[model samples]
Target chain A: MAVDKNLPILIVDDYKTMLRIVRNLLKQVGFDNVEEAMDGSSALTKLRESRFGLIISDWNMEPMTGLQLLREVRADAKLAAIPFIMITAESKTENVIAAKEAGVSNYIVKPFNAETLKSKLQSVLGAF
Target chain B: MTPSNVLAEQKLLRQRIDAAHAEAAQPLSREEVGDIVREVLTTMQGDLSAQDLGLYKELESLARYIQHARREIAAIRPADIRDCHLPTAHDELDAVVGATETATFAIFDACDAIGVIAGGIDGEQGVKLTEQITRIFEACNFQDITGQRITKVVKALKHIEAKVDALVAAFGESALGALEADPEPAGDAALLHGPQLPGNAINQDEIDRLLASFD
Candidate 1:
């Protein structure tokens, strides 16, 4: 399977800086079509309103966390298969295991670069 | 009846005084002077130092703990209160330090990335780098966020100090409590910012591997 750089991606985080960084990293890795959401609820609204190929979100947030967002997406029959990636500074084994069990397409940790993003995308979406 | 012994002591002291007077007026010897002076000074110090030794001990305990706690707070500077000697205040100090380090990291990492753009890269690369810089700029917002977070800790510290002050006053605490009020920073003591939280810092590679393990 070939990854599509043209597909729109949504990046969610409590920090605006992170949203921008992830957006840039995605663009650097040839995934240019990126959007932003400050929290899971907004991401869900956007997910319902518009089409996004992927969701990359931070694990810690108020109102809703990335994990909660992932769960919501997975539970929604229409949006269940949209390839979600949980990105966060939290590396606790229980958290990762929880996300893994929750049906996340993948996960990424903080301070990652373009190459890491590219590879993660490839592993999940196949070579592009 | 100590008449014999008492009479002999009075006569002996009188004889000595008379002898001294006869030669030249003599003042109390150094030992006598010290004893007389000590009586008055001891009473004054007791009045000034504390109501009693027990209260003084209480005061000492508070002072010593605050001093020790401040050292722990100092260690918290680079983040992580894991090394603090006093466990009671570890969480409080760690909160302030962690927020401080996070803010510092945001500033430093932003600057470092901006340093990376030396020249021309085109299309996606340029766009990505541009977004990266913008993101770094956005990260600078951590200052206000962390500053706000730290303000709460500062408020808590002040509140605790104030309550301690009231306790001291209610207990007739000594002037030493003022040291905390007008804290004199000890020695070359500045908050030492150490390193990032080992748990929080993870590179993208690690994430990739973790994700692979999931598969």
Candidate 2:
């Protein structure tokens, strides 16, 4: 499947450096319309304010965690259907199960290289 | 007075003085001596008169002096220990600052890579740019690795703090003992300066190779 290059995407991570890295990586893989959030709450605010085709989020964060954000997204009628992917350092089986239960489209563990990110994104977007 | 009686009186006086000195060396608190004085007076069968008063007065004065000396000794120990700890705390702070500086440089390199990739350069130039971007990611990875090292360093520093606290507490408890013991103040500062672990020390060439994998 071919990913829409123009689709607005939101990337969430507490680290500004990681956000920039993911944003740049996504841009390299032909997704130019990408935005960023430093945490889940900010991401939610951005989601409510604007439309995004995909949500890629980091799991560990202060205040509202990624899982909480994922549940919130799925519970909302307007935001429920937006494709959500989780990117995190927590690679435990239990954590993966919890994310799957909470309705994650895909999961990627760090420190992932460019190709791994591409394939994961393609797998979820069905564009690989 | 008879010569034999005079000699007995002198010997008794000398014994009283010796007991006073011994009591002075032990350094009992004020409340402890009150009960001991009561016990001694009761045991003396009401014969405690002015003739025996001098020795008791002398013992009390000596005990007071020992207590004062103990306090002075206690007060000086931590000041001495802290004199050594200050420099070590400063050194650890410097190490943390250095780590932060290295992390900042890594952030700059990552930003530069993103800029190059955004410029839309292609061909061998693009490949080099991608190579540079990979280097940026490698730097990012180092950032995480260095972060872990910093956490370990912080934990070690915390352990140092705990050790210093324990030492200070022990010094406080033995203030009186230390006064009598008169220990030579050794330079224990060296003990606090433990083996330094390398933090944020990255091989530039290795990072370059990791980045090359993207090509």
Candidate 3:
């Protein structure tokens, strides 16, 4: 399918700065219809309340982490099909494997640039 | 005589006196009593002096050790570490996170304003300006990473502060018992050490390679 730049994107992170950065990066990449949640539980609430085409989330968060959020998303039949991308500072092998096992669509390590974000989004959403 | 030898000599003397009393048909005469008194006094003078000297030496060693321990513990100044330095360090790191967050948001504000300014122009210069603003947005992400790193440091400082507070409490039974007690992190979460410091953790390229291997 052709990429839908207008599709709603949900970005979840505990840090305000990271959320802002991801939103700005997404805006730069031509995806301005974005929403944010501070942690996994809130993100899940938002997901249940509304619809999102893609989920870009930080792997680590309080109360519920992104991995836990991914597991929840995968378990829910209603929300399981949405593409999920994990952006995290946890660069350990096990962390990546765990996210993969939990059914992440793509992974982006921290300190990434707009190019990386764009390419990852393209890979997940089809070519822009 | 050594302290042990003195003890042995005194035991022997008691035995001898018992034997004498048991064997005698009559009570000890004056001369006999005087002889026993003289012998007891002579043995006691020598043995007691040696025993006193040995005990004095041991007491002196103990005193020295106590003095040294006192000096070392005093030098730690647990009060200062717990009350002053640790709090200062925590506050300073908190300040750093706050300052960086403020600066990062300010940068964001500037970038947004620049984007607006760039929107008016209709040329490559406008495109270039927008790109530069995006670059600033990406660079501003440093605040998030730095904030996480500072949080880790703050946690370590808290652990250290806990230890100092326990020390200041003089390791009372309750304090000592609680020294090693930290709430156990649940399950896989235990393995999650937060963002590694520079040079300590794997890079993005390595993570990408590992993820590719899975594919």
Candidate 4:
């Protein structure tokens, strides 16, 4: 699936540093219009307010984690169809299972390199 | 000499010899021994003279005092032995461990934020930042998972900080610059505004497609 360059993307994490890093990576992959949120709840708020072409969220966070965000995104009538990808240090089987169950399009383990991220993205987008 | 007188003299001689032997057998006299010790120690201490006999006596006293101190020190147990309560040590260890865990988690959180940001931007700048963040996250995970070395997290954070600063500077120069240059600030301002956009006008399919890349 060809991704639209103009589509706004929302990247969520509690750390501002990670947000900048993810935004830079997405820029490299040919997506320029990007946005950021520090937590799942804020990300959800962003999702509800504007159009995000994609959401890349950290799995662990305060108030609302990535899993909670994924569930929220999937449950909402208008937001349910939005693709949600979980990025986390948790690579446990149970966690992956839970994320899959929560309607995550894909799961990327922490410490993933650029190739791993790109391939994972392709797989999720069915662009691979 | 008379028999009694001879016996007394022999006894006196014997007692003198015994006294000498006893004095010799014992550690030593504080004064005479100090001379000998001073001779040996003076080699280490540089120089000495007979005039320093008073000083030598003082040194002997100090040595005796030190011997007593040595005995006292020997009587006491070592710190680890005296305070061998595992619970308290464990508590202290746990405090260190807890701090380590917190620091590790913070690095992980920072890396997560980097990943999120990398997922949002575009072009060479994005790739570089993404790679840098990925390396940092890898370093952090390696420390936590393999080495269990929490100190590595500090190094990773430092690396992330440099990258973040670079990105922020770039963002200010490019994105902020463009916004400032644009005559129609309204459209650009809307993008700069927080997540909430107007209405449900956003294209879901595009969003889905974009997010799919993370998968």
- Pick the lDDT winner: 3
**CAPRI level of candidate 1:** incorrect
lDDT of 4: 0.66
> Across residues B81-164, which tens digit of lDDT does each residue of candidate 1 receive?
212322335444565656655765666576556646623665777656666664564455454345445546666765665555
Model 2 C-alpha lDDT per residue in residues A17-122, reported as the tens digit of each score = 6776787688767788999999888999999999999999988777888999999999999999999989887789999999999999999887776787788888
Local error of candidate 3 at residue A73 (angstroms): 1.6
Point to the candidate with the largest DockQ. Answer: 3
User: Tens digit of lDDT per residue, candidate 4, span A16-121?
Assistant: 5456556656655666798899988878888999987678898877788789889889889999877777877778999999999999998888766556667777
Native contacts matched by each model:
0.03, 0.09, 0.84, 0.25
Docking class of 4: incorrect
Q: Which of the predicted structures, 1 or 4, would earn the higher lDDT when compared with the native?
A: 1
Range of the 10 consecutive residues with the lowest summed lDDT in candidate 1 chain A? A20-29
Q: In model 4, which regions exceed 4 Å deviation?
A: B1-215
In candidate 2, which residue pairs get closer than 3 Å at backbone N, Cα or C atoms, i.e. clash?
Answer: A1-A127
lDDT of each: 0.67, 0.74, 0.84, 0.66
Q: What does candidate 3's lDDT look like per residue over B1-215, in tens digits? A: 89999999999999999988767734333445556545655666756677665755565566566555644655656666777778877767877788788888888898899899999989999999999998888888788889888889998999998887766665333323433333679999998966444466799999999999999
Q: How well is each residue in B37-80 modelled by candidate 2, as lDDT tens digits?
A: 66776788678888667767776777677667657656555544
- Local error of candidate 4 at residue B188 (angstroms): 61
Q: How many backbone collisions does model 3 have?
A: 0
On residues A19-69, what C-alpha lDDT tens digit does candidate 1 reach at each position? 655766675567888889998899999999999888888887877978889
For model 2, what is the error of residue B18's alpha carbon versus the real structure, in angstroms, after optimal superposition?
46
**Looking at candidate 2, what TM-score does chain B attain?**
0.36
Task: Please provide, for model 4 over B103-132, each residue's C-alpha lDDT reduced to its tens digit, 9 standing for 90 to 100.
Answer: 766876776688688778889888788678
